[model samples]
Target: MVRLPLTPAEVARGQRLGALLRRARGERSMLDIALDAHVSPETLRKIESGRVATPAFPTIAAIADVLGLSLDAVWAEISRPEHDVTPAASAHTRPERLTA
Candidate 1:
């Protein structure tokens, strides 16, 4: 079956997902994480580079589990609109004081 092309939003989301995973990986080697996730290093690299934009759910779950990331949080982060601020970004912003 021929797969339909992904929308630009979907591509951006995939890139965001890859960025989040890479950040969470910190100093760990790609090979180590891939081995722990039970996926080939090449597969992990592809996912990390956003080359495989729509990876299988099981593969994502496995990687998330290995990385100790909350799948729900990952979904929430990646699902937000491009113009919206992420929780992480918002958290670092200064709060406004209420003037009575």
Candidate 2:
């Protein structure tokens, strides 16, 4: 059966997911992680670089499993605000109000 191409939104989501995975994988060799995930190093490289946007679900599951991270956590990271100001603003404001 022919698989349908991914939508633009799905591609963006996949890229975001890949970026999150990369961040969580700091200090780990891509080859090692890929081997653990049961995917080729080149495939992992492409996923990390967002060259292969919309990677298969099983592929993502494998990577997430090897990373020891939950799927929900990965999705949450991807969906997090690109420019999260709440934490930064709260850090400054919370101290002032408590002192005042």
Clashing pairs in 2: none
lDDT of each: 0.77, 0.70
Please write out the lDDT profile of model 2 over residues 1-100, one tens digit for every residue.
9988887766776677777778768889999999999999999999988888877878987887777666666655555565542222221111211110
- Provide TM-scores for the models: 0.83, 0.70
lDDT of 1: 0.77
lDDT of 2: 0.70
lDDT of 1 by residue, 1-100 (tens): 9989999988988888888788778899999999999999999998889888888888888887788776765676678889976644431122342111
True lDDT of residue 51, candidate 1: 85
Rate residue 97 of model 2 by lDDT.
18
- For every candidate structure, what is the RMSD over all alpha carbons to the true structure, in angstroms? 8.5, 9.8
Model 2: what TM-score? 0.70
